[model samples]
Target: MLGGISIWQLLIVLGIIILIFGTKKLRNVGGDLGGAVKGFKKAMNEDEKGNDKSTDDPQARVSHDDEGTTYDVKAERKAEEQDERK
Candidate 1:
């Protein structure tokens, strides 16, 4: 029984990989794959620390109003022009 992979099987797998991606390009694939795994793990650690702030935080408040804020310069200018016209 050939418990280990035969030379022909190894060659076939290598040939398929080379045909799909050239050897030189496949060389960098290893480093790129490792970096992706490392980034995922770092993100998981950050998430466990309760600091992924993209979601809402208790300390942050956003105010929305129909009257709008005082920084609405066009509204302020229109009001000033109306007052001057009177």
Candidate 2:
């Protein structure tokens, strides 16, 4: 009656799964899954918060690269400030 399977058929499948896996293994699997979800949510929230803060303050911005060369991100800002002084 549901998804091309009857209620009794569904119950039988469920019973077989429980018999094979047992409740203890199922419980541990559920707990591990829940922990992973929680960790992912926490990481996402922290990243969002960091982005929000950096957008409001230019000095808080950061640039990353794999090479040894270094770049100054605030060079433009310094130029603007110098022009303003003149």
Candidate 3:
């Protein structure tokens, strides 16, 4: 028994869900859900592999503005915080 509901009650609830959604719609929904999970796993694996390569490259740490100005972003942020105190 789950939440005080017996196996028979659970079966009734499952039957209602299938009847409301229909078998084909339910199958499509299941497929879409599975695909999303697979894609998310693939992206996470790629990020882990990519981060190691990027961190070792100095140029990858610099961010460029639209005006073509480049700055050491971490240092610039610290400078801004110090300025706010004065």
In model 3, the runs with Cα more than 4 Å from the true position are: 56-59, 63-86
Best by the lDDT measure: 3
lDDT of 2 by residue, 1-86 (tens): 67799899989998998999998999999999999999999999998898878766666566565578767769978998999999
Compose the digit string of candidate 1's lDDT tens values, residues 1-86. Answer: 27888989988999999999998899899889999999999989988776667456665555555565357789889999999999
Evaluated at residue 60, the lDDT of candidate 3 is 85
Error of 2 at 77 (Å): 41
Leading candidate by TM-score: 3
Q: Write the number of the candidate with greater lDDT, choosing between 1 and 3.
A: 3
Winner of 1 and 2 under lDDT: 2
The reply for model 1, stretches above 4 Å from the true place, is 1-11, 51-86
- Model 3 clash pairs are none
Candidate 3: Cα lDDT at 5: 96
Q: Model 1's lDDT to the true fold?
A: 0.84
Q: State the local distance difference test value for candidate 2.
A: 0.88
Clashing pairs in 2: none
